[model samples]
Target: MVIDLPFIWAALIAIAVLAYVLLDGFDLGVGILFLGYESGHQRDIAMNSVAPVWDGNETWLILGGGGLFAVFPLAYAVVMPALYAPIIAMLLALVFRGVAFEYRWRTERGRFLWDWSFALGSTVAAFAQGVALGALVQGIPVENRAYAGGWWDWLTPFSVLTGVALVVGYSLLGATWLVLKTEGKIQQQARDYAVRAGVAMLVLIGVVSLATPYLNPVYLERWFAWPTAIFSIIVPALVLGCAYLLFSGLNRGYDLQPFLASLGIFLLCYIGIGISFYPYMVPPSLTIWQAAAPDDSLAFLLVGALILLPLIIAYTGYAYWVFRGKVRPGEGYH
Candidate 1:
């Protein structure tokens, strides 16, 4: 059987990106939450909760980017130019945050500086990602397989709104993660943050959902069409259900359920996005098949991906399992 190599690669990249968002997202959320706490010990506990697995979680992002470059070079070419500024900013923020993770422990006098760097880095990175998503969803100007828009084309009110929304979303994820990973005062603080962030997230989701159709008509048509419309209801239904679970779980002092429920909300949001733009990779302009590289190149890449992807997943799972436990005071990356 002649396999559809392009489709397979597309699916693989999608999954990789989803994994990156969910895994790295919570850590980023934790970083954002650092700004809220005054206690150094409480912050230490939060840092330790994510310290072991955070770097490993970022590997999925690398996989997603590499897969895109290899399998859909055309899309990469167009997208990179369109989002050059935000992408560069995101990378720099990630570098700062990574360095903060190590340096915060080394210098007692500079710890405050490093802590701010970590929190600000995480916020900037998350916002840049959201801006990129907003720009893509609103449709970049593409002509002759190239970006036709100016550098500032990505700066818009909708993009800004999405950026703030993502900050709230990631903060929620981080708060839930703390709920699962820490105990005592830090855990209670995280539970409080989770409820606040979760409510803000729901409001942003509604705003984005309402604004999406107005920003682009295609999303409206795809979402409300007859047979598909009925299916689409499942997305919102699951979101509401998960939101309820998150709140109830936190209120009931269930450590793991809130985190799991927050993840469900993230997954449902991703699925809704996929449903809105299934065949299109560039939104209203480029189809997946149109952006795909040559079949022979994809076939070559697929062989390497098949060998490497499973191993990466196994290692990631193992790391999480090894680090499974509650973080306490005076315990961290030292």
Candidate 2:
């Protein structure tokens, strides 16, 4: 069956966003867990847990951006222009984290610098992305698909809230990941953080879910309407179940279960967002209908995805298989 261009972009962006979340999710999570470590040794362990596959996972981000640029060139034109400054900042942070990853273990003097840089870079990048997301959600000053605003235009209460939320979200992901990767003191610290972060995240999601709907009546009507209310109950129920498993797994020393549970929470949140903005890729400024590529573009890209997606899945699975094990002392980060 053939679909419209808007549907194609919607589907592709959803895939891109999911790839970014899962691929970079655990790495950003590592930085979050870095703060939970007692020493550089534990830090190294946490870092190494993700090092083997983290960079490979980044191909999805590149692909996501590239796919968007290709399929929804219009969105690229609109969003990048409105978001030039923050996007640049986000790229810079990504650069610093990449640099710090390589430089951290060369010497003692450089150790502290690189360690702080990694954490700072990760934190800033997460916050910046969140702000950009929030700005997009809250809408930018645009006329004729071009930004018509000053430097401070993107700075708003909603955008600031998004920055904080993304930090918390990343920290939650990191804590869960540590629970999966390490053991003993590091494991316990990670477990503790996961439980706390889980609870905090649960509350934050609830508040945001409620508030975001009110942010736009279009959203409000969609969420609060009849029958769709069924999903409302189901989504929260699933999230709560995951939260329950997270704490239960943490308390029982169940190792990887907490991580799996946290992932469930993140995935559920992803679903909620997808549902909330079903037809709108660029809220208040553009609809997915307005921003999609042509039919020929979708067909070409979709064909490539069918071939490449499976290979990506296989490689990611194998890499995880190869790297699976408790990180040992003196093993060091690559």
Candidate 3:
């Protein structure tokens, strides 16, 4: 029996990407919510809720990217070129947002500018990520391990809608995080935002669900095909269940349930996408086996990945544990 090393690497990289999205995603969401908070104090409290762990949360992104480059160099080569614009934009936005995180408290004179920078940076980064996802799902032009698409191929209406959807989705996650991590009127305000954002997120999910099949017939086939289809429905059903639980928990004034539920929704959505594009890493183009690096190289990478992944997980868990509790105004990573 042959062990599929490439498949294992693919799954590992997928896990890393999902971890980044679910973890850093909320912090980014928190950054976006900074725009909604009019008071500097409110923003400060919100920022502090995530500040201790935001940088660590981003490590998964680096892991995911690095793993992809190492394990599936061909996919990296094709995808990087296809998504050059949005990827660069997202990187720049993240850089500015990280800068804002440090500088916002350094000088009163430029604080306002820094605050706007954080909010704009978060918004653009999230939108760019969604656009990139949309472009991938809608299909990138790849031929002979290269991107054959025009520069503007990624800028379509569906991709734009996905971008807006991600903004609202991230904001919802941010609001729930605030609800879980803060107290006082800010908590109440976050709850209100969560409810509204939840509604918007649901609508976007419906639109995306409908549009996905129209944009890609392969999705339609996978979604409605036999036993696989029956299993596939479970993902969306779980998402809806999470949404229901989130709303119920919010109404009951439960602090952590709503955030957990929001995370569950994101997890389910990620799984659904994975189901839609299981074999294909470059979406309708390159399959994992086709694009994977040599098995010998994968084996070498796997040994190092095994050693580092656990340490990263341990550190991340410890950081969250150390900072666990409701955040109060003026008590944070400043």
Every model's TM-score: 0.98, 0.94, 0.98
Residue clash pairs of candidate 1: none
| Candidate 1 worst ten-residue window by lDDT | 223-232
- For candidate 2, give the lDDT of residue 276: 71
The C-alpha RMSD of each candidate to the native structure, in angstroms, is: 0.9, 1.8, 1.0
True-structure lDDT of candidate 1? 0.92
Model 3, span 1-334: residue lDDT tens:
9989999999999999999999988999998889788767888999999999999999999999999999999999988888889999999999999999899989898899999999999999999999999999999878767889988888899889989989899999999999999888999999999999999998999889878876677888888888688855787788899999999999999999999999999888888888788889888889999999999999999999999999999999999999999989769867
lDDT of each: 0.92, 0.79, 0.91
Cα lDDT tens digits for candidate 2, 224-284: 7987767888999999999888888888889888888877888998888777776776776
What is the C-alpha local distance difference test score of candidate 3?
Answer: 0.91
lDDT comparison, 1 vs 3, better candidate: 1
Q: Candidate 1, residues 1-334: lDDT per residue as tens digits?
A: 8898888988999999999999999999999999898757878888889999999999999999989998899899999999998899999999999999999989998899999999999999999999999988888878988999998988899999998999999999999999999888889999999999999999999899878876677788887877778746888898999999999999999999999999999999898888888888888888899999999999888999999999999999999999898988777687
- Which ranges in model 1 have alpha carbons more than 4 Å from their true place? none
Ordered by lDDT, highest first, the candidates read 1, 3, 2
Residue pairs with backbone atoms closer than 3 Å in model 2 (clashes): 29-174
